[model samples]
Target: MTDKVSEAEFLQGLIPQLRSEGYEVYLHPTAPVVPPFLADLRPDAIAIGKGKKLVIELVTSESTQQKKTRALANLIKEHPDWELRVLVVTSASRGNELQVQSREQIQNFLDEIKLLQDSNHVSAAFILGWATFEAIARRLMTATFEKPQTPGRIVQQLAQEGYVTPSEGDFLRILAAKRNALIHGNLHDLPQKGEVEFFREISERLAAESAAA
Candidate 1:
């Protein structure tokens, strides 16, 4: 079993990463909404934002394919707004084999995301392993600023337009710090506490902006 503290810390970091990419995220011990009678229902992470919602059920113990299938079905029914994704982030210490397995899982998950996106059930979904963290962060942040303008530039423009606050400007800088950590593999050196708080603050501001728009 993986250390609970480490797992929690990892998930904590994941929240800001998703938020920086413009996702409204939530945490849950089980499917956020489901019929009360269904036992053994849980998902490690759940996030909703930007025209999409997602449920990520992480498998950490011995489980049957049938069980997983059933849970997935119930989850889909419960949160129709969410595109469902499953991941098994293993503690397999073997390097090459672990990498191969993770890649296969992620590819399959991406395929599902594409299918959902095409069907209009969700904007996208992704199943990720620990090693893919950096790649995922980079992709999400990159997607956020796909226009001809950089994120910093966009933020500055928005500030000039009175759409973002000076505090929001500082939050954007915090995002830059997180991005740097992702790119440099220095997550330990990243400002964990401030990054998360600032991310939430900026997300709230953006949500208000979106609502007003």
Candidate 2:
């Protein structure tokens, strides 16, 4: 791994190896993104697990404080949500890398949500479906925001950051409220089946668009 090809070779060798361990890893994501608080700096890749996010950095040398190496440490320190893991791979023969633990439950829950969406079970579908989607939103918010926020505030932050439109944010706020009420057994305030589906549709669209953007 020498020349300009080293970085690409490193990332290519590492990606599937990481995925094989069951991480929801993203590589230099182009959309559905909020950069780290540090300007002009982004992790080489990110991996999300149960309650932890990993920011991966490839450093050539640690003997000196290169701009990127210093910035990477600062960004990790600033974002309490993420754990920083740096691989010092300067030498061409270096093969060291972090073996991140898996978060299979999250993937399982997402699969369950898809199944619920197609099932005839009404209340189970609505309640679990919304909760699952909310879990996703919460994960994104935790990754983006500096501090914890309420559900509505999460949507607000997304909108303020230009990730979501104001109209979409309004819709999500109402949806989140209904999801919360459902979780708390406020059945009377629960959205109707159609309403629930509508919210899910909109949420799915937003997720898909952002992923594809």
lDDT of each: 0.46, 0.55
| Candidate 2: 10-residue stretch with minimal lDDT | 97-106
- lDDT for each residue of candidate 2 in 1-213, tens digit (9 for 90 to 100): 552367667777777766765667877754455354656677777777677676676544222323464455555556667655544343354344312112233344334434434433334445544444444454444455333335777677778877677787787788778767755546577556676566566556545544443
Give the Cα-based TM-score of candidate 1 against the true structure.
0.35
Candidate 1 ranges with C-alpha deviation above 4 Å:
1-6, 29-40, 60-66, 77-79, 92-213
> In terms of lDDT, which candidate is strongest?
2
Model 2 stretches astray by more than 4 angstroms: 1-111, 138-142, 145-149, 209-213
Question: What is candidate 1's lDDT per residue for 34-133, written digit by digit as tens?
Answer: 3243356655677767787666554431223434534464547555565665443444333222222233343333333334333433211212222222
Candidate number with greatest TM-score: 2
